[model samples]
Target: MVAPPPIIVLAFFCGTSIARSASPGPARPAKPAPIAADARHKQLTFRNRPRVVRSGRMRRMNMSTSQPGTEIGYTWPIRVYYEDTDAGGIVFYANYLKFFERARTEWLRACGVDQHRLAEENDAIFIVRSTAVDYRAPARLDDIVKIISRIERLGRASVDFVQEAWREGTLLATGSVRIGCVDRATLRPAAIPPSVLAALRHGPGTSESAD
Candidate 1:
């Protein structure tokens, strides 16, 4: 073949370089690594553990106590796990707060209240304003504890609760929690919706307790 002029070859090379430069390459995002099988199994196990369980075995029993006018309003059962214990092996004092919180949440659910719906539909949410807990004894791992809760006082925007932790008729702890209603967006105090207030007053202690 006859050789082209050096200027012609140079022009062709320059045009190819310009074309390559102007047409950008496609971008490929890096893919996330897949989770390991063991990790996947652990995650599934955690998800399978339910937040609450109400069974037919949980029957309402009118409890008589030493305290004046003390009556059980709601009861929730909890099993102490190793994670709930402290270095000394007994249930951690602070973990009682978690127990009390769970009991109150379940109590409200029994009262026909859904906290998520309250926040989304009514713009209202419940917040713990104050809490006082007294420890009488220690709870150990694998022990099934019952949290007995009752309304000590009810107000337009807040509620006072009396909660106790018991195991086989032994009192482990007692807590007084005050919950206040607030506007979810503004975080300012707000009145409890009338329907919710009515439910709180009438829903619990009116029917057989879920076993």
Candidate 2:
């Protein structure tokens, strides 16, 4: 056979090298985008971690304690209705007391103590003995305020609570209220029932030594 031309030999060698170098092996999927990579990492991390589902009461407790100027307590949300506002378009000052009252009631309910039931079954009733309130800021109409109620002192026949009203992280009002236990029929001072006392001491966001 005639010797191949030098140019043809060079071309053949180059083609063979390229074919060998470009041969397909195992295929790799494309790399993920940066965001996708981060998301995937988060997903894996979440899967590997223990999942904790907190109850509503626990969530409120955590939220109340995590913020500045907030005490560990039971929190309740209240919406400002038009009727709750004054002609100046701000929440009426007295309405904050109402808000505090509602929160305290809810707190007691959360403690598994029903006031009506307590009165009917145990002949026990709770009455507000005293209240001292300080208004810090004004809450406008339609504002949703969170009321935090914490036990300050547990007396033999009375319980004092420190209540605060917060709007969007701003403390609007703070009040100290004392609730006294009494006999529903006699209206005389009475000791808080053992069951109710136990419930209050073990209520959500409260420590055993709270009393």
Instruction: Please report, in order, the local distance difference test score of every candidate based on alpha carbons.
Output: 0.83, 0.83
TM-score of 2: 0.66
Pairs of colliding residues, candidate 1: 55-211, 56-211, 57-211, 58-211
Q: Mark the regions of model 2 whose C-alpha exceeds 4 Å error after superposition.
A: 1-71, 207-209
> Candidate 2's C-alpha lDDT?
0.83
Model 2, span 1-211: residue lDDT tens: 9999999999999999999999998889998667777888999998999887766632121112336555568889999999999999999999999999999888898999988899989999999887778888999978899888888667689887778888877889888788899999999999999999988888865644457
Alpha-carbon TM-score of each model against the true structure? 0.64, 0.66
Shift in Å, residue 179, candidate 1: 0.0
After superposition, which runs of candidate 1 have C-alpha atoms over 4 Å from their true positions? Answer: 1-71, 205-211
Shift in Å, residue 185, candidate 2: 1.2
